[model samples]
Target: MDKIATVKWLDNLCLVGQTSSGHAVVMDGPPDIGGQNLGPRPMEMVLLGLGGCTAVDVIMMLQKSNQAVVDCHIEVSAERAETIPKVYTKIHVHYVVKGRELSEAKVARAVNLSSEKYCSVSKMLEQSAEVTHDFEIVELS
Candidate 1:
């Protein structure tokens, strides 16, 4: 994998990640110290990356099961220990799925499967953080 980052302006950074497929993702950083609204904070990017990874796992799993997944949202909250490392002690993930007559059992099962076996992000997080998951299903109006 190849990536690049070019300095744009004061306290601002533009980052890119290149995949083996010749695809790229551009990200940015801001001067957190001076409150420069240049780009997203690093910690925010970590959460977003984790969310994106798990989201793909959940959506693809539900789709493969023919669950008619119209929409799926996952909210993640992590408790960081107040120390130098500031490692996350616990993480709570709440998944809200929307579709036409979606199944609660299927949603729960999908989330379980992802956290337990499917989602690489969840598994990676499990090494250092206590990750938990819950879900709510909404039927189309």
Candidate 2:
């Protein structure tokens, strides 16, 4: 574990994370919501983190399998409970893969590998929601 954040108030999570050069990511929550919003809403960031992680994994796997990846897109949708203890109940991930000579099996395998082994965010989110996925391949000009 690394250095942690101590909450001085509600909605506020301050962390003292250091860069390799000893610089810091001085993050804060929104002041109106008892933080600075400088670090972004935790939930929002979570979604992006998942997308980024899975995106990299997909790209890597496709490249290794020799797919000429022109571009990739991931869309994430989540349903959250509207209550005090809000949590996601369902989530759907759609992957749009644009390339040349793309194999559906290879794309499926890449997605599976990311969700099963590489993406930590997806694994954690799975505990809360029934995560589902689908993919489409688009040939380029």
Candidate 3:
């Protein structure tokens, strides 16, 4: 399937983007780069996209395995190259999964499947960055 997006400049280092699904997001650069902090930086959005993509896959997989997934949070940290056309050189994704009686094996499997096979964003970034992952499980009473 093909995806489409439209971006319109919103003056002074800011832009409004609309996805083919009609969802909209605002992107801007730093004040030094002429942004007024109106929204997230474009690079930040890439991190968010990776997190969102993997989180969805994990949650769905856990649900399918009958795991009680009450909450799921993903944190992504990245380092960008210090060169022209800066790009991500390294990325680490940490997942915090909360639920009652969560199985570690199942959770690990879910995470591995997403990072290794399911998440397109993660796979794409792997070409330019070293993507690594870890997870922590929080059991609820």
TM-score (C-alpha, index-matched) for candidate 1: 0.78
Q: Give one clash count per candidate, in the order shown.
A: 0, 7, 0
Question: Candidates' TM-scores?
Answer: 0.78, 0.75, 0.98
Question: lDDT tens string, model 2, 83-116?
Answer: 8578888888889999988999999999989988
Clash pairs detected, candidate 3: none
- List runs of model 2 lying over 4 Å from the truth: 4-40
Worst 10 residues of 2 by lDDT: 3-12
Per-residue alpha-carbon lDDT of candidate 1 for residues 37-141, written as tens digits (9 for 90 to 100):
545655666666677877888888888888888888889888888996877779888888999877778777778888899878778878988999888888887
Off by over 4 Å in 1: 1-32
What residue pairs clash in candidate 1, if any at all?
none
Q: What is the lDDT of candidate 2?
A: 0.80
